[model samples]
Target: MRSPQGVCLFSLNFPPEPTGIAPYAGALADGLSKAGFSVTAHVAHPHYPEWIIADDYGQWTRTEERGRTSVRRRLHYVPRTPRGYRRLLSELTFGLRLIFDNWRYPAAIVSITPSLFATALVALRLRLTPNRPPLIIWVQDLYGVGLAEVGEGSSLVQRIVRWIESSTFRAADHVVVIHERFNALVTQELGVAADRVSVIRNWTHLADPPNTTAVQARRQLGWPADVILAVHTGNMGAKQGLENIVDAARLAEARNSSVHFVLVGDGGERKHLESLANGVSHISFVDPLDDHDYHLALSAADVLVVNEKPGVASMAVPSKLTSYFNAQRPIVAATDRAGITAEEIFAADAGLVVPAGDPEALLSAIQSLCADEQAAERYGKNGRQYRDAVLGEPAALAKWSDLIQQKFRDSNQN
Candidate 1:
């Protein structure tokens, strides 16, 4: 029997994935649970950024409880190479499992995307059910915009993807977007009603860094203490355009500069990026770190970096930015000048912005920051201030809780 305060959440990524959308989804589930909702999250096995499932989690199906939430993990195709077609296959496999699984009628439903295809399938199922519960489709990444930006397929394919995305969004009772910029895109481009969409910015999920100097952090991590360390953390994917970082590192090496580039985290493109940086002594790669070490690495960096593929503007705002802000480290973004990322950095006064895919310009920005300590300090301070004022965790979670309660009331009324 479904409880009055029960909420169903569909997320392809969940806890143990450790990067990208998983952390945010996990946080939301926990927040909802704490708000007195019984959250039953239907999720896939932990295969993300790395795209490989662990040996111990080889089960076809599993169920577990975490605090007030019940987690059901389903087996899906773990694509070794998550290209366009293979990725679709993976989502299709997950969606088929979800469609066949027994579902409890909850007060409301929350669905997250990135597995946009799977979410759309679930949305279609809800539409056909009589007296379906209200649904909030969380927009983590805009699928159609991502397809267009990445140039994955032909124009016809892009149009079809947009149509699917639009239909899925329109089926939702309400839509939650992480950035204000997504409002126009959702309402105008995707044809969702303006009133149905709300912006709830993502908050820093990482714990505050340990109290230690950069020198201490460097020593602990075994990194050189005498270099200007520029670090980029998170997934090294196609959209990330991490090759630009490799090229910039090459430039720094050629100029005999003190800046050393560290690419942290794993993804589909890590091998490709490693190949690109082969024989480039200025660049190094670090495996994904635990919570404490992750925070420590950020604290040790002289400049934190965000890199995006050329023309990837509206598709996403890097999730890493929230943690970067919390680290109070100066950032340097190499992305489209007119994109949402540059706008965000500019708004927070967080860091420098250079054109995407420009090796020389990126190198120059890093060198400039290394040369000016006061300016770097100011940028870091501004970012921390912005994070505290705009991205408080309690406020964001309360908004979500209120939305769920209101939806439940509306459902009960009908």
Candidate 2:
């Protein structure tokens, strides 16, 4: 028997994994539960930004309850170097597990992507079910766009992935995109109807930063206080193109620049990035920090950075930007000039955008900000204002709750 308010959420990542899509998906599950919906989240065992399973979770499957939310965690193959065939295997293994699992019909279903294959498989299952429930796909990143941008597989592999992605999206009763740009991409490129998409921007999930000076924060983190610290947080994946940071750090070292670069977080590309930065004194790496320390790390930076590969344009809108905004710090984005990331930084009026893959340009922007304290302060103020006005958590969550409820009501009526 299905609970009238039951909502089954399929997300590859979930809470306890601090960065990437996990936090947003976790927030949605919690928000829906608070809105009086019983949300059953079918998620993978916590293994993300750091692609290793959590130490505490060794079981093949486990179930836990958090208030009104029921979480089902399934173990999947996690590749340390998540690229090429290995990455596909990981997604396929998880998707197969989800497809074969016994499912209970719910009032509505919500699927989060980046586990695009897993979502598609479940979508196929839903299609065959009698009196199928409404499926809503919440897109955090476009798999088709990512495959093309990363150039991971061959042409045939790309086509298969795109076919799977478009089919799954079209199967959904509706799609929720995080940005307006995604609407056009979905409708035009992926063959989804315009009316089926909704845009609810992602907000900062991190708590407010501590009341501490940058000098004090630096002291606590053991970072040098004299130099200007340029921090880049979040995933060090291929799309991040963190090699640009290494190159810029090398340039700074060559010129004896006072700027120090710090990368805080881990990902598939972290090892490669560290290799590239092996002897570069100007660059340092920090493992992922807890919430309090994460915010402190963001607050301690003189300038926060958003870096992407040159070709990565519209796949995602770096979730780190929301946290950066909440930190009230000036941002310097090294991304495609016409990409969604650059557009976001421009919209927030929070930072400067430099051409992607250009280390000299990145270094120049950081130095320019360092030289102009007033300008940096102005940028920081603008960011905080934008966060409060546009990226507030209450607004985003409320919109999601409303959408889910409306969809549930509509499904029942039909």
Candidate 3:
């Protein structure tokens, strides 16, 4: 028998959830298993972006195996609607369950934050144990700040959340951050030491896309031959500030511009956005595509998009960025210059950045890309090259395995 993998991961998100951090989490677990560490993931029922338990998830809890890794998905309370208090209650219910649950084998615990409170419980519980597992709190998204970013939560709520965050940060032996800006916030703003954090840029799900031309894709997608196609795929949630995209589309339609906007994916704000987009002929929404079509659409598009509302910086890095890069298309990001999305796009020289929450500016950027073919092609090439170098699978997966060895295996031996 192979050496038992001394790692256990606790997180609310996992695969078959459609969007958010599930794909990334699943990728990590799968990679770890392939690298010869038997992994166990306590996956909570999927209740993200859409905020409802998917009908097919079935019953309270069940255990399944993903290759060598075993996954247990528990039934947690899912609020009928996605709201702050309801979400908090769900975390409380799930965290408490995990806290009281058995740990027959001790291993270095890897807990993720989204339900930051749940991770806090694990951190606190580990502290009370005599032989505490070396804890690693994975920072995928900043929760308290994210709530405020989407125009939810109050000052009191934020304070309580931050207190939990600070406590958990202190509790973990090492805090892993996927984006550099997150590292800055944790150390400079949250009072954590700089040395305690590790940055591993996320790996992509879309790789070595079949070389396809936009003209051919437009034909397959049943789009007009002359219009420019700009597509934004992934979750259509509040934080995305999709209204800006809709408004820009409306303006473009009014001006009879050649540029067209298409949004693909589902989320809480999708219905509301559909209502907002009712009369705009140039703007259209498509349901989530199958993998083959998704890749085709991405590779075929003239441009990709990443948008965020104003005053919403440092909370999320938009997991869609990896997919955008893999699509080999230049993008237009309408987000704060201070945000990670803007920083990464500019650093990769992947696309153009416009003022956050400005429909007029978004329209201008889209038009300019349509107007200049050479500049757009250059950006596309640069992004594809950067994705291979930085976000490529071999590099990211090796970094994760190295982390497991350094933080989990090495510490165990000593």
Candidate 4:
């Protein structure tokens, strides 16, 4: 392995992906370039939430952009199935296309994944290239757990996928996990060498504070002044356990019909969730907001809530929690605190924590926060201060620059 004068990032998601990692990869690419390493982002056509390719990228093979850094778009199949099987095919198809697309622009391979279907391809690419730049596997979720949770395939299929996942982890020059719990999962469950793993929290998506008053923002968004609004914005997947929110909403509506529960995002389960909330006057759903509007919409919330299914604790460090923390709003986290979700809110003293999937607990915490306005404001302000000091742009950018540089040096040493 040898270092390049530049770093190339291979990520499936990019700018229009509308998820946490899209912006993160973009930021890293930009940061690496500004830190004196030329950067290229190899990304698939952006189609997220709805799982259909964006209308703007129609029939185009590739496009280059110079916003944060040089971005290279590649075409990949967008799965039309809800089953994880077709999704796996889509991921593999993208990886195959990426291999050919990146063939001439050889550099170190720093790939990310929840898709084990592509792990073997990436591992084989690195293994075959004797002078390959180090392959750093940036892990967000464990493929073994994720596959099982999503019901992607059968037991035998998962076993094979797990083998692929293990092979990639074993072959990778460095394995970076997002949290300490994940690092432990690698060492204890996957039997990875302790020295090969590193833990780094992904930064939040807090942009400039939206220049709108809470009242004005609420009015503009068609929200009422009397209701205590609880906002949930992110992926709508089974792992989110959003049903708990519906249950909590029912309980809250029973207590004070004025309280409103707002869901502001798209996901696999969103339509079903909407159906369940059909007759509930207090439940509201809105189309996904653009980045700027999203920030402003969050400002109107009295509390932010995040829910994770049981056993999904270490599998994912929910990226939305960072934005919630940075929004300076009290968080009602229905997730394990061991993950970054708990760490951010608890450390900042910004919100209350409850066990995952417990509607009653979520209801109680929401009630507690709503009941005490002064306490909620204090917690929210402290959270903003904590985010600025730790997870803000300057700190996040510096840390990302250092790690990419470290990867550059680590590759050279290898």
Stronger candidate by TM-score (1 vs 3):
1
User: Where is model 1 poorest over a 10-residue stretch in terms of lDDT?
Assistant: 1-10
Residue 196 lDDT (model 4): 81
Candidate 4 lDDT at 230 equals 87
Candidate 2 lDDT over 1-414, as tens digits, reads 556788888888998899999999888888888888888998899888999998898489999996678999988889989888888898888888887876677888898888887888889888888877788999999988887887777888888888888999999999999999998999999999998889999988877778888998988888899999999999999999999999999999999999999999999999989999999999999999889889889889999999999899999989999999999889999998888998988998999999999999999999999899999999999998999898888899898888877887777778
Off by over 4 Å in 2: none
What lDDT does model 2 reach? 0.90
lDDT of 4 by residue, 6-88 (tens): 67778887777667577777776776677776677878887776667778784546768756467788777786444566777
Cα deviation in Å at residue 142, candidate 2?
Answer: 0.8
**Stretches of candidate 4 above 4 Å error?**
1-3, 80-82, 103-107, 147-158, 337-340, 406-414
* Clash pairs (backbone) in predicted model 4: none
What would the per-residue lDDT of candidate 3 be over residues 250-331, giving only the tens digit for each residue? 9998898888898988777888999999989988888777667888788778889988878788898888888888887899
Ranking by lDDT: 1, 2, 3, 4
Give the backbone clash total of model 3. Answer: 0
TM-score of every prediction relative to native: 0.98, 0.97, 0.93, 0.91
What total of clashing residue pairs does each candidate reach?
0, 0, 0, 0
- The 10-residue segment of model 4 with minimum total lDDT is 101-110
lDDT of each: 0.90, 0.90, 0.81, 0.75
Model 3 alpha-carbon drift over 4 Å, by segment: 1-4, 223-225, 409-414
